[model samples]
Target: MAEISQVSLGDAIYDRVCQDLVEGKLRPNEKVTIRGLAERLGTSSTPVRDAVQRLLRDEALIQRSMRDVRVPVLTEAQYLEIASIRRELEGFAAGRAAEMVGPKEVRRLKKIVERNEAAAVAGRWPQAVKYNQEFHFALVEAAEMPILLAILSGLWLRMGPLIAGYYAREQLGLVRHHQAIIAACENRDPAAAAAEMRADIDDAKEGIIRYIQSFTIDE
Candidate 1:
């Protein structure tokens, strides 16, 4: 019974840390310690250690020493590689979502964009970043493509920290492409939806490259 409980606790801890990565709660290159995370989460070190191990394996976290673990910062090449892949996969998901999206889903997406815009304007960058992720994930989920969503989630786990760094450094104007995507979904135009999704992903390229360069300079 104790062993089973520990296993469950480990899984729970793993998912909580994953949310931190996926939601950009952690920043790129920020150092992490099991003791700190355990305290922050009000848990023991055992489960936190287990969860951090999984993130390390996922390449979401990099270990610099026996005790030093930090979020991995992507290079310009790495970021672009992932972004290119995202354009294809997420664009396909958006196209499929356009095919299946109903009025309710369209409204939900619009609401998400609205919230994201508001957060951006208010300079609540973390909130904006979270809503941005929510909007993309919502679009993919609407497609009802479980396998695609799983693949995208892995990509996002790597991107979230890097993206958060960008957002913290700049203002957001990416919503125009998102709005275009919403319009394409409203029109039930799969090609337009896919194109707009690709555009949105493309828009990130410049900002992410700039951010990556800054990281390189800092390091």
Candidate 2:
């Protein structure tokens, strides 16, 4: 089990909403209610409002006027745009971390990757997604660039659901992709790290597109 620190009320709300999005409990373009969110999170309306505001700023949620909100619909173009930004930002983060990643950090990342692999094999999709997120975040944090990390955080929020959906269908390939990233970091090869990161992001985009399209004909 990974050490997931308890977050503030707002962050807790945000993560729970994000998890719902990933699990398809909150579908694309579905309207969200503050009261509903508060009840679901077992928190008050204030933190739920704060969380929704933050997600709106991230463009993960659409805010209509002062009272209404909806899940941002995932369009092909929008998905591509977000995927491109993530590739550029995260690839840069991985490359930079390669420059500064020490033995301790590498060891931690390896452990996360290993745990993530095990989780995936055991069909624990949520745990796999959680570990995968921690692994990437650990690398980005190791870069030691607060501004860059902050920027990447927004991009990652948008990427979360697509990633979760992708892994819900495909597991072994995703696990292998993480292994490639771990290998690049272990070898301290920044260029390889960036290339692998981009490839992984691109693959994820394709997988998500395919997954959505498979269901579109029925809709």
Best model per TM-score: 1
Cα error, candidate 1, residue 153 (Å):
0.3
Task: List RMSD in Å for every model shown.
Answer: 1.4, 5.9
> What are the lDDT scores of the predictions, listed in order?
0.90, 0.74
- How far is 134's C-alpha from truth in model 2 (Å)? 1.7
> Which residue ranges in model 2 land beyond 4 Å of their true spot?
1-31, 63-70, 214-219
User: Model 2, range 47-78, lDDT digits (tens) per residue?
Assistant: 78888888788688887657678776577887
lDDT of model number 2: 0.74
Candidate 2: lDDT of 63?
72
Output the worst ten-in-a-row residue range by lDDT, candidate 2.
Answer: 1-10
User: What TM-score fits each model?
Assistant: 0.96, 0.78
- Tens digit per residue, CA lDDT, model 1, 12-131: 999988888999999998999999999999999998999999999999999988988999889778888999999999999999999999988999999999999998888898999899
